[model samples]
Target: MAKRNRKKNQAGFVFPAPLAVVLVVLAGFSLVYVCLKAKTEALGQEIKALESRSVQLRQDVVREQCEWASRLSPASMEQALKAHGLVMTWPGREQIVRMRADGTIDSSVIPEVRPPARYARVDRVVMND
Candidate 1:
């Protein structure tokens, strides 16, 4: 770009009209490009930070699950039962009650709960062929 000589009183050179306008436009574009580049870099940094946090959280969850599983092993459960002095036994025949296929419960079992009137027969009815 050619710079024209200014008047003797002026300190700086003057640019032609067309050249000045072009220079102004180029400067505006440069400013916009710099702002956009900075924004893009900021967003990239934020994404990297979030990804690192997500990975750390996942690792923490896996570690916690492993610890939980180790604490609930069969041997640990047996030791806990012995520590509490609790006896382990199977249910007796009298403690178990058999259910009948009919709507009425087994007579051997007391306090039979009869089904509601609507539930007496659940067979579906066909309509319109």
Candidate 2:
């Protein structure tokens, strides 16, 4: 009877060792899962902040472009040109003169202006090659 009782106690001890090993594995896995969750949340917050900053920069660019356009109207451009002693002149007609390589000259008539200017009835000349 003493021998049988000793064997039964040894069997119970063997079962608890495996159960302890399983608990240790489960604890390690739980720690890893928690770490990954925290890292993912931090990365998501960073992405949101960067996106908000990008949107604000885009809005600032659009506002600056509109302000510049409002200040640089046609009248302002004309005034600035005149301040530099530069005047816009329109050509009425054109006469093309071509010179040959052998010192010969050939002349032809070309209509350089079609429609007149907006405010002034002067003809604008456009040269094309």
Please report the candidate that would top TM-score against the real structure: 1
TM-scores of the models, in the given order?
0.53, 0.48
lDDT of 1 by residue, 1-129 (tens): 867655554856667889999999999999999999999999999999999999999999999999888879987777788898764556545554667787665867654354533424567899998
lDDT of 2 by residue, 14-99 (tens): 44767889999998999898999899889999989989989999999999998888669887778888998678765544534456
Question: Whole-model Cα lDDT per candidate?
Answer: 0.79, 0.75
Per-model RMSD to reference? 17.4, 14.0
lDDT of 2 at 63: 96
- The candidate scoring highest on lDDT is 1
The total number of steric clashes, by the backbone 3 Å criterion, in model 2 comes to 0
